[model samples]
Target: MLTHLSIKNFAIVRLLDIEFSSHSTAITGETGAGKSISIDALGLCLGERAESNMVRKGADKAEVTATFSVKENQSAQAWLQAQDLEDEDHLCIIRRVVSKEGRSRAWINGIPATLQQLKAFGALIVNIHGQHAHQELLKPESQRAMLDESGHHDAILANVKKQSHEYNKLLKHLQSLLNEEQQRIDRKQLLQYQLQELDEFELGIDEFPHLEAEFKKLSHSQALLEDSQICLFNLYESEQGTALSIVDDALDKLSELVEHDPTLSAVTTLLSEAQINIQEAAEELRHYVERLEIDPLRMQQTENRYGKAMELARKHTVMPEMLAAHHQALKEEHAALEQQDNDLASMNENLDILKSSYFESAAKLHSARVKVANKLSKQVTEQLHKMNMPHATFSIEVVSNGEEKINSHGTDEVRFLLAANKGIEADSIEKVASGGELSRIGLALQVLTNKQSATLMFDEVDVGISGATASVVGQLLRDLGERNQVICVTHLPQVAAKAHQQMLVTKFSDKDITETHMQPLSQEQRIEELARLLAGDKITDSALENAKGLLQIQQENLI
Candidate 1:
């Protein structure tokens, strides 16, 4: 329930603070007394679209703050905690600040929030019905929504939502499978070419290493042959003295000098070891000379193998060393694509299973709604009869044949029907309801949904009624107030007399400035205001007596 409202620099209201009672409250004033401004303030607080024109002249900005006592609002409390906002006890203050620059800000419990969040909270806090009710009756979708809201079918709707989700998943899977099949068709020739190239080479991981060794020998063939010939010449075949003979002569001299000194004996031992090493070097040099011959066929084979390896590496965008990993990955991808026909069949089978499961769940939800729709229409029409629209033919507008596609909402569209007179043809309320009739219809639907909603606000609901009809509206308002807190703004004296609490909105001028103020009317002040509403500019004796009598009657009944 809305407990307090504070407004500043909004149109005719410079500054005003109004407190509310938990029962039915009546707001009444003369014409042009800024009565609609109060409801406008509430609309701003509830995240309505605002413009800079709402700001008063000479004012920089406009602001509206509303406080709701959340002692019984468990869902709202949990939502606040989910957002990591404070929820100490059940008091939440939702404030809105609007600037002349078209900037707006919202706050919940003094924590800043966007307009979207403010709307989410407002949906849980209050339901306002004004001329907007006529606008709502125009849309068949809203009619369906209201019927579902009255029947409390959110759980069934949730199940339909889950089914819709599964259907979408299946559709996406089918699209992906088709896309892959198309790609395979486009790349058929390319895959065949690549497969033949790789297979002809008989590629292996160690093939590159063997080819690299051969290429090194062929590319430097002249250098390898020259170095081998030099070794052979020095050790065995050269006409000039070779290294091995030089060492031989040095060893013989050292052997002869060994008899002269023992130091010469150590030197003669080193020469003998050196002569043995040269003899082994001469044998190895003869073998190297015989084997250093280069073959042109082998060189050609190495070059061809290296070119093939380089081509595959460049085609796959990889380094020579990474060629092995790339080769394995392509082989796997080709292997997978080769079996796509079989894989596509498997995916289709899975999609069929998912679609079947989704349809089965949706069918159950549709069954539940079909069972409840007729009963809902009857209930609303019965309530309308009590609200003085006896001839109104109200029914749930649904396709009885169940031919529409099942969606997140079940396969039904609900709308109300009405006729003003006995001979009038029944038409949808969207096409044919008068101003006063629309207000009463909105009131009936809201009061009907009181069990689901937390609080109800009716601003100027008694717009198109007078005399005895106004009294019946008064009685209906009292009935609603008994069930839940109902705040109604009215100019009718009868409606004001029936409220548990009545508030007066008035504007008065003091020298240069005019201010609007709101306060709870005391019992005597309540009578004066009621008389003023009854007798406009002149307070007649009969009007005052009638107002006093109304006050006495309401007090006796309240007691």
Candidate 2:
């Protein structure tokens, strides 16, 4: 329940602090006295949109803070704990600040919070019914929503919504696949042909480079043999003066000289080593000449293989060395495309299953709504009789033919019907009800259907009601206050007289500034305010007595 509200420099309110009662509280003021300003300030604290125009003149910013007791509100407490914003005192304090530049900021329990978080948390604790709430009640969607809210249909409704979402998602995918079916077929066929060609080529890793090397050797075999023979003749097997023979002759000369001088021994040793190296070279050359051969057949075969590799590389728009890698990539793509085809084949079955699940849940939701709607109609009719509509007949029509297109809210159409007189057929409420009648019906629905919030606020919802009916509305709110905190802003004296507590809004203006002030009324003060409401600005003795009598009657009824 809302415990306190502090507003600063907001609209006509300069600085106002209001401590609310746990039961019914009435806010009253004369015309243009800014009675709704407090409600607007509270709305800001609850994350409503703020504008620079809402700031008081010459003020830099406007600020509002609302405090709520959460000891009994487990949902709010859980939300606070989840956000790490819970206080040790079990109180939720929400604050909002709007600057003159139209910028806004909010805090939950002194911790910085986003506007969306404030809205979500605020919804758990407060439900505010605006003056024009009946306008929304006229909408068919709102009617359906109200019917659903009256019952415990959350689980079934959630299942239906989930199945509908999945069904739509899959349907969209299937449609897209069907639209591009020809393209997919063409792509698959192309991939298959390319893969087959690469598979038949039978390329092996490192085989291309080795084949090139062997082909080079075979193509130039004759040149290689002739050059090797020439090298052997020059080095060791020359006919004029073989290098081996020359070295032997030099060694013999050096050997004789070395006996006289030891320095010549180094020369003789070098000549002997040279003669051995020349002989080894000549032997190796002889072996090469023996083994060397020209084979046209093997060379032709190698040439053909190399040419085919190059042709394939050019055809595939890749280098010869990258052909193997490209082949693997094509195979992978073809496999994925085949998988997509398989999925397409089974998509319809999946969609049908989802559709069946959605229909079943929606049917359950429709059945639940029918039961709730019957109870709601009976309760609302009883409430209307209490609000001076003695002969009013109210009913909620829930109809589903099972042939309507699937939607998140099931297939049922919910309509609120009303008949103002006895023996009259009830028609759609929007078409047959007057403004006052609509307000009464809208109020009845609001009072009965709103059971989730800890605090319920009615901002001038009794606009078109007065006299006995206004008194009944006040009593209904007072009854609701027994279970939930109720705040009502009204101009009706009867309504104001019925509240356990009353606050009066008075506007003061001078040449430079205008400000609104709100204060809880004392017993005498309440009498005076109620008198003013009953008899205009002039409060007569009789009006005071009437106000006192009204308060006395409400007190006796409470007992």
Candidate 3:
């Protein structure tokens, strides 16, 4: 519920601070006294768009703050928690500021917030029904929305929307596959040929590198054999004292001197070990040289195989090392292409299933909407009777278009039908009712459908209504306030008298500055305000008496 509102430097309202009750409150004033200005300022706190003109003539900026107590507003509380903006005291303060340059900012519970966030929270907590809201009944979308809201068809509507999305997705997928059918077949044949050619080669991951190494050795066999023979001769068989014979002579000299000096004995041991190592090395070299014979046939065969591998690599536009990976990719692509027909069949079946699912949900949604429409029509018609239209008939017409494709909100087209007189047949509200009748119908519908505890603000709801009917409208608002808060801006004394709380808006001028002010009314003050509403520009004795009597009746009803 809205607990308090503060508006500063907004339009002609310099500063206004007011507290609200949990019941109905009426705002009353003379024409041009700025009664609707309060509602306009409150709208800013509800995230409504603001213009530079909304700021007072000389003020730098305008600001409005609305405070709501959320102890019983579970949805609001949940939203607050979800946004991480919840306060420990369960109070929500929405503040909006607009500079003279048309710049605006908003905060939720002291944390900076986007305008969208503010609007989202506002929708959950308050509904401001302007004088023009009644005209929206002529719109088909609005009519459909009312039916759904009245029926509490959230779950069914969700299912319908989900099914519609799934159906469209499958349809698009199936179309794409069908469009690509011939192209996929051609691709499959090309890939099959490529894979056949690659498979005939029977390539291995490391075979290219090994084959190249063996080819180099076979091609240079004669040169390699000549070099190894020169190395063997230098190590053991050269006529100018080969390394082995020289080491043997040095060992003999050291052995003879070993008894004379201990250092010579160590030298003799080193020389003998060197001779043994040299002899072993010569024998291994000889064996290696013996294995180095050239074979012309093997060399030619190795060169031919290596050259073929290189030619295939260049044809495929890949390095020899990458040939194996490229072949594997072709194999996978061929396999996938071979399965396209089966996949297409499966998708077609899935699309059929999705289409059926959508229609089923659409039918259930239509049924639920029809049931709710019937109940709402009866309820609203009864309400219209109480609003002084005894012969008025109201109905909801739900027609299923049964189009081949579904829409986001299902296939039902809804319209509101109304008959304003006894002998008149019910017809579309757009063609039958005047502006005044439309407002009353809207009021009746709101009173019947609004079961949530949100505060309802009505601006000029009593327009074109007066006399006994005005009193009935007042009573309806009072009753509505029993379970929710109602703030109404009205010119009718009957409506003002019925308010549990009353505020009077007055305009005054000082020198060159004209300002508007609002003040809560005491009992005597309310009597004066109602008297003013009863008698335009003058309060007579009879008007005062009537105001008092109306107040008394309202008091009794409250008790």
RMSD of each: 5.4, 4.1, 4.2
Give lDDT for model 3: 0.87
Off by over 4 Å in 2: 202-316
Please report the TM-score between candidate 1 and the true structure.
Answer: 0.79
Best by lDDT: 2
> Per-residue error at 181 for model 1, in Å?
6.3
Return model 2's CA RMSD, one decimal: 4.1
Q: Write the per-residue lDDT of candidate 3 for residues 1-559, one digit (tens) a residue.
A: 8999999999998999999989999999988989898778878888899899999999999999999998888998999999999989999999999999999999999999998998889888988888788777789999999889888779989988988888788778778878998998888888777777778876787888988998999988887888878877988999988889899888888887887887787788788889999999999999989887788998998899788788778988999878878888888887787676777788788877877787788888999999999999999898888888899999999999886667779989999999989889999999988876787888888777774767889999888888888889998998888889999999999888887899999999888888999899999989888988888788999988988999999888767
The 10-residue segment of model 3 with minimum total lDDT is: 445-454
Residue-wise C-alpha lDDT for candidate 2, range 241-336, written one tens digit per residue: 877878888888889888799998878878888888888989998898889888889889988888878888898999888777777788899998
| TM-score (all chains, Cα) for each model | 0.79, 0.87, 0.83
- Per-residue lDDT of 77-117 in model 1, one digit per residue for the tens? 77777877656767888888889887888888889887788
Minimum summed lDDT over a 10-residue window in model 2 is located at 445-454
lDDT of each: 0.77, 0.88, 0.87
What ranking of all candidate models by lDDT puts the best one first?
2, 3, 1
* Top-down TM-score ranking: 2, 3, 1
- Which of the two candidates, 1 or 2, achieves a greater TM-score against the reference? 2
